[model samples]
Target: MNSFFDGYVNSKTTLRLFVNQYENALRDKVEKENIAADFHSFKSIVPCINHYDIEKQFQSVYTNSKFQEFQKELTRKIYYYPTFIKKEGAIEVYQVTEDMRIGDKRKDVVYDILLNEEEFEVKCSCHHYEFRGILCRHVLCLLREKRIKEVPLKYILERWKKNVKRKHNFIRCTYSGMEDTSVAKRFDMLCNTFYEVAEVGSISDESCNALVEAIDKLKILFSTNLDNSAKDLHVQEGPSCDGKSKTILSLVAVRSRGRPPTLRKENKVDRKSREKMAREKKAKKKEKENNVKGHSMEIIKHNMNDASSAAGNLASQDEIAQTVLVNSSAHYNTFQTA
Candidate 1:
């Protein structure tokens, strides 16, 4: 002790004393306040998760229940931690000791999985702290043995969801005394959107269904079944119509009216006097409608004639077709005999 003190006589001695005193102070505060304690969920998961095989690849990795249980505890520690502990009201403690391998091995093998009795290193695929939201292949392998169809909702909601919120740095629980105006506005809008769409005391499934229903209703309400622009155009200039079908071909309608060739500016529409324009449009529309009705009547007459002709053809060819079929079948038989 004297030699140690003598070696750091001047500046070094002061620094050493300072570090030692700081460490002592921090240690005393922690011990006195009992600051180190796992959350409630930690205690609950420790017992429940104590003995679960996480690896079907090597189910023998954890030969004992103790190791499996320990592995679960380790999972909660790595994945749940602050969120799980905060939420799980039942658990008050979660504790585990280091593992001891049979023969001395490399550091990698030693701690690959040393949480409780759980053979984590061998069984656990997600060894790191993150990547716990969705079950890794290793956990799924274990769950399959236990016949768990899917990862538990408890793990997904309380454990995984909370972790995701923390990782992504989600919204503050309450925006108390927040200074960012833009953030506050956006948050408010989000809340408004949710409340507007979601009913009181609705479950997630119902809420999602309700949102879909609302979206469908909105779509229907905003849908355009008819073109209002056509109505407006009809009222505005009588009819800028040609006797032909309404098309790009009839845009030069006035030219076909035997008037001197007159070119309107690119964007301008030369009506050839509004009264004359109105007369042409009315006459053109009457002509077009008459033509359409005549065309429809002709189509109907043609269809009826076609059906009649087809019927006569079928009746006349029926006997001939049957004779041909009989002759072909007989020929096939003759070829087989030859």
Candidate 2:
């Protein structure tokens, strides 16, 4: 039973904020030297990594276990090179036909390697690039076998890069303590002072203790000022002519271009009355249908009775004509005998 206006604050944005904070925390744990070894090629493209996404690789390391395992798997390829299948124009095909031990169990895992020598485009049957946006061990092995030192810029994804653009100011709509213009200005000044205090307080424990004491004294001063302001009779000045008090304009509700609606014109019927009318309408429709059905049945019965009576009358007339014919024949025979 959620209302239409329930999500005033975007849930996705809020969730993203939490995720960014988590990433930032993980980013602090990442060692820059480790990134230099693993993502050396990435450093050439971007000068400095985004502080927020500094631990992107660290997060990916735990999430993509297959990728971490693949790094170790590439060592086995050093012993054997993939079988060359065929070369068609710019593309070359290589096949890994033998069974390899992956993870726990040894299984027959066949992978076709398609390489474009001219364009440096590489594709594998395992589709590791499509799945995880990184090259599989098979392709990496091929590169190592070919003595390619650096990974191509085309293959490296921008999102996985260390120096991708970072969003600094994410604060959109934040609440201000004061509503009045003058109060808001004073509050801004107070915030500046608080920020300075916080910087000084962070130096040492003694300084922090002194800062706390000062804050308590500042609160007392603010309380006294609040009391003085409360006691003062503030006058609200507005537009005035000469020495006379200004007249405040009243807000009038504007009427549309139509005659004012009378109370009788409005549909003020209660819910019960409306429902009763609907029920009556439905009942009348059902009664009308029943009456039509009854009339049709009565007409059919009358037609059947008229047809039966007509058939009975025709049979009686036929019997009477047959008796007359038999009597006339007997009289003729008697006259002849006489």
Candidate 3:
């Protein structure tokens, strides 16, 4: 069915598409120097999104194939600019007024693009050439629209929706055991990007060294910590609150204390009893009404019979009176006292 929401514009995505189209059109209209100048002008005029923040937000969601596709699309818009992903689609701009349930905030923004038929809203932040992630505000905005969950990755793409084969091949390196030369280089990289200095005893040191990127490795050192904390608290409801959670008795701490009233065990019987009583009352009322209706019908039938009998008797009486008058007149004409 073509429902109410089917025709509604995706305000955010439309605005994003508009901005993208506008940027591209302006670039095409100008010289290379003008493009560089435009970049500078755009930076000064528009708010910039932080690259690090976006990268961190994206890191958790990047494993999905759709997200990877979006990344590829963004890459094309920038360095690749491939002709395969057609740029002929119309970029529509719109505005949306969303009332957030949680924060209770109403947002009004100059929309960038309501693109991909409202699949996603395209937004820009100054830090990088790539798209922005679901910032808390963006999430709130979507929730206000009653979207219920995070926006999917496909709607944010700037290029083809398919993943492209990586252009660069991995190069293998030979290692010598003496100095562990890769370690120092990796350590320096980590220090620059992450913490300033990794402790000797810390697992941060493991990723700091060149042997491996610190994806999820090096948790052995903190295994005991993770176990003690994870076992204590539930992962679903909340994070470990000082790790004091007990499995069974934790509810006791949260539950109110008092001499509570006793609860009935046989609630089903009570409900059934009440329902039976109500049904009996309804049936009795119906029977009484039926009896009244029957009595009224009998009375009406008797009244109609009485009316018919009275009319027949009156007609017979009229005929007899006429006959008697005719007889009297005939006797008078016959003459004499006889």
Candidate 4:
């Protein structure tokens, strides 16, 4: 049993080490990929083919991949022409037709676009922004007709932004032994906030000293609160009723919910020990048998000596009787002669 437990513990340790190594390797791989992506996006520049101010804005803000997608829609805007339909309150509706050509077939697809000029918001029936998070050619065409210089800030998704720092990127990988807990997320958010503060604070010596002092005060305050809370938790006891403490006194050892384990297979050490015990037991039994036999022989010899002594006493008694009889007969014959 001890050996089995030892083996189980060793295997668990080995498995944990393997998992740690694998997680480290996976984290390194992801870091390399992210670095490579950043390098590629930074080094390579995609020229603005449409020469539109909006295309240039997208090229500067969006990553290379997302910029290419926007460029495709920008280039395809020539095929779409928007016609003003009607105005309803704040929204002006327009019908945009696309002159799409596939191989040898030509198809015209009409899409309805609602434009809010006041808010600079555009919604298209193609639902490109809704699905793929990119403005459709129809909406771009309508925006072009309206002479809008750039896309709205709301339409530009943070996920595809080149400069935006993603929160998930700060989160440790799933296999990196750090769970994606709310605390971790909050920590990342706080780190970003503090980083911005640090950047601003470092602009001047007074601001930097003030920031450091404030951070030290906050750290002390938080530490004190944590210690107090921990102390309170430690002093708190289990609930009691009617002045009686509800404390667990003892626990019974319950059998596990399974069939009892069979005898373990004997290893070389166990086998040798068992054989040694068996040999010692057999020798003890033989010694006990010899002692019993020796005791029996002594008892027989004692009984034989007592029987020989009784026989010798009986012979002496017979000789004394014969001598008394001979004397009696001699006395009778002398009396007769007188």
Clashing residue pairs in all predictions, respectively, total: 8, 0, 19, 0
lDDT of 4: 0.74
How does candidate 2 fare on TM-score? 0.31
All candidates in order of lDDT, best leading: 4, 2, 3, 1
| Model 4 per-residue lDDT tens digits across residues 1-338 | 33323212232345655454444445545554554566666668889896679888888778798899888888888877899889999999999887779899999888899988888888999899999888988888877887889777898998887655455654565533234556566777898999999999999999999999999999998977665553221111112122321212223347998878889886999899989999999999999999999999999999999999999999999999999999999999999999
lDDT of 1 by residue, 1-338 (tens): 33232222333335655454344343333333221221221222222343433333122222233334435544644332111112123322222223335567523221222111222212242453234333333333334333544332333333221111122222432212222445546777878886865664265887677778887887676554323321221111111112311111112223455667658653334545766789999999999999999999999999999999999999989989999999999999999999
3 against 4, candidate with superior lDDT: 4
- Candidate 1 TM-score versus the reference: 0.18
Which candidate has the highest TM-score of all? 4
Query: Which candidate leads in lDDT?
Result: 4
* Alpha-carbon runs more than 4 Å astray in model 2: 1-70, 98-105, 166-338
lDDT of 1 at 293: 100
**Global local distance difference test of model 1:** 0.41
Q: TM per model?
A: 0.18, 0.31, 0.22, 0.46
Q: Per-model C-alpha lDDT, please?
A: 0.41, 0.58, 0.41, 0.74
- Shift of residue 322 alpha carbon in model 1, Å: 99
- Model 4 TM-score (2 dp): 0.46
State the displacement of the C-alpha of residue 15, model 3, in Å, after optimal TM-score superposition.
Answer: 23
Ranked candidates (TM-score, high to low): 4, 2, 3, 1
